[model samples]
Target: MNLKNTMLKITTVVAVVISFIACEDDFATVGSSVIGEPGFNASLYDDAMISAHSYDLPAVQTNNLPLNLLGVYRDEVFGTQEASILSNLLLTSENPSFGTEPVVDSVVLAIPYFSREVLEDDEVVYALDSIYGSSPFKLSVYESNYFLNTFDPETNFEQAQRYYSNLEPQIMSNINPDVLYETESFEPSAEERTEYIVDGSGVTDTVTMAPALRLKLNNNFFQNKILDKAGTASLLNQSNFKNYFRGLYLKADEVSNGGTMMLLNLLHSDAGITIYYKTKVVDATDLDDDDDFEELIEVRRSYTLKFGGVRVNTFEQEVPQFEGENLFLKGGEGSMAVIELFSGPDANNDGISDELEFLRDNDWLINEANLEFFVNRDYTTGTNLNEAERLYLYDLNNNSILADYILENVGQPNSTSSAANRLHLQPLTRDENGNGVKYRIRVTNHIDELLNRDSTNVKLGLVVTQNVNLISTYRVLPSANPEVQRVPGGALLTPEGTVLYGPNAEDEDKRLKLKIYYTEPKN
Candidate 1:
């Protein structure tokens, strides 16, 4: 028989079997004349059939978002990932006031680092979180003469702008015509620095601050761009300033062996450019003295320009293994894994779709459901190759989020208490022997809806947890509180991947699993 006809026949047989079983149970109900009395306590429903399969997800758009760049780096398992950033500089003030006789001291660019702290015993130890392969590559900064057009004149619809992952740098002739600033290979530091804080009584106490990247820019470059035209009309407003000074393009030069990559948070409060100078001031202390009558003294002055405006992170991925197999779960937007639950092949082909249908035919109360993914330890256990700390699971077909993710308030406030966080799965953990490190994603509500409600069963997508909220923002409506705009959002641009065991892998013990815990009614 055809597949549809066979399914109908199996469903008919399941209905008949259920009716017969009900009849038998009804016959056994002898002493239930008094209504509202419980029939029997409960019985365990042990046997539950679960189906799982995985496929290679198509490449997704990885650009025109808030994702920061991960500079040049090459991994043995994940191949190469090189990233660059193009952004506009924002003015700190409308009309910058640099006094006459100002002397340029220095120009500096600062980008903050991302770090986390762990409790060693009683004290907390800080470490870099999203950084990998910390060797170091030559870093360069160039003035980007290529202007990012804010609006498209043709459509005039605010221009739903987007830049792709595979796009190359369209360098302009005004790119300084020379490298503005170049630095030798440098590694990011996790060490802390001491900062002295003075109280109202002038008593000082030292505290540690996080590490950051502060590059000293060329003084001559900024002297001409910023200081020379202090009183000009172009320097009177931010719009005129941006139009005159274009932007910057930060490029990390190529490196042969294992080059390093660092993830920077340009939007951090500490990340920006500062121009230091000294303006002429009269020595008023000795003005009354004939020895120092109105002597010119250098008084320090500084103006800051923050990193903002049309910041776009471009990503390029070269994962050849992704073309040949489906064994790993890559986190970047360019590549990710497709997950299918209850929608794989048939029982004859080693899939569990048919098995799930069989269980659905039988009326069983699903107590809890979970999906666990085991990492391919053979490929992910090197000194440099570490596993991602958190992973996010979402519905792939919807291009939105799973309803359970919202109902459970996965990333919202106060959703992290013991009872509240039950919906959010625990972090990556391993067995006692430390052999199989796995991640478990809770899908009890998803399974319950699939089995009980009229919800659509679509494939799911998995990625690093940070990618979920990378481009998410609140949109205000007429009556409701701000709603989230989630679709077409960006994913992780940082180059990171984890090899997870698929359902069809060779090892049965380490294969992906969909486990369901249930209970059956007793009479």
Candidate 2:
């Protein structure tokens, strides 16, 4: 059925169901009078046929994302994943003129990490967020020659060009042989950086900035490319500059047993390359002298090239094929679970399963439906391991949010609480020691529609999400499964993962199952 018709039917049924619930005091009598019965009895049904399997995702589209991931992350359950970034630099202004005899001093590239300021012992300190691992990793920066097009030429310049996570090999092949910057061992620090700046008069001033990945780039590269090309066709505008210099490729390599992974905010205003140069300027102080002699002195000046235009994230992941009883869910070209509900024999040659047909044949009013995923603590228990805060469930066929999620998030206040949309997508439960327990997701509306309305029973996709509110999806280039062309965008932003008990889990009590509460009129 069309989505509009389905939504209208769902809305009308929900309104009727809500009205019936509002007058619950007379529901039993009303139901009894209509059916010539005594009353209605509510019961819990936990046994329902469900099947779930894990699918390893192919390289997904990763261009022009809000944030980018860099470094290597190794998980005991899902193996290792290495992330890198390639971006085009843009001038702050067009057709810039450098004063005569402009000499390059130094060039620095800075990218901020997700962090927040906190007070510790009455002293303000910065705390890094969304950073994984502790060991150092090797980081290398190279000048890329690959041109990232804003529009796809194959599509007659009508569609945006897409870059996938597996483009590292292609990008590396197109880079300059000489590395721009490299570090044998690099790790993110939470401590604020203090810089001492000196003016033309040799007066030093101290400046404090937030924590960021600051590195000194090859001065000759910027000097020859930027300073030497001032007012030339190459530096005339952003378009010409991008075609001239292309971009930079930040590559990460494993240096130790474990490597650090950090989410970088490259779009920040301060995140870019700054070129410090010396220019000759007339000394005003000397002009006021009695001799009225104007002397030229070398003054320090700086020009910044911000990261703009097209930016793409490249990932190299080693995810093994799933073969276990438990399901593994990892983000960023990792893995996801495909869930099937009410899987049983359809003896009548109908689409609806016999088990679901039985529930429909009996006039049962569904009150609640929940799918609980128990965490396999044995695999996820570690001091250094980080688990996903929430898991998102959606219709895999349509690539849309479930009805329950839409209903629960309606009119939700815009607050900072992590517990938002708790009714439908509950956050991961934790123990007293902060270990993960399980995630219970409500799908009452979805299940009701499947049984009471003409809504199709579609397969559900489950994945780890950074935020529950971000329901947008991004296309998965060369999708692993034909049915799954796209996955949740929030899932691609996170590197965290978890192993959950699947339908065929060895532990009967912990096996994933749908629990439904319903009321039926007593005969």
Top candidate when judged by TM-score against the true structure: 2
lDDT of 2: 0.81
Q: Write the per-residue lDDT of candidate 2 for residues 1-523, one digit (tens) a residue.
A: 4522331122213234345456843121112223322475555567778989887888888888888899988877777789999999999989886666888888889987778999999999999998988888999999999999999999999999998889998998899988989998999999888655556453457789999999999998888889888879999988899999899999999876789999887889879998888876666676335554467666677788999899998988886866787888998889899999988768788898877776676666767678999998978987355799999998999999888775643233334244377768888998998989899998877887887775798999999988787677877886435867888877887889988999888999999978765667667
lDDT for each residue of candidate 1 in 98-205, tens digit (9 for 90 to 100) = 767887887878776788887778888777766768677777888888765565556674665444444444643546666667876766777775544434222446
Residue 509 in model 2: lDDT: 90
Q: Model-by-model lDDT, in order?
A: 0.59, 0.81
Q: Which regions of candidate 1 are displaced past 4 Å?
A: 1-67, 116-126, 151-154, 171-174, 191-209, 281-296, 322-325, 344-363, 407-423, 431-436, 467-493
In candidate 2, list every pair of residues with a backbone clash: none
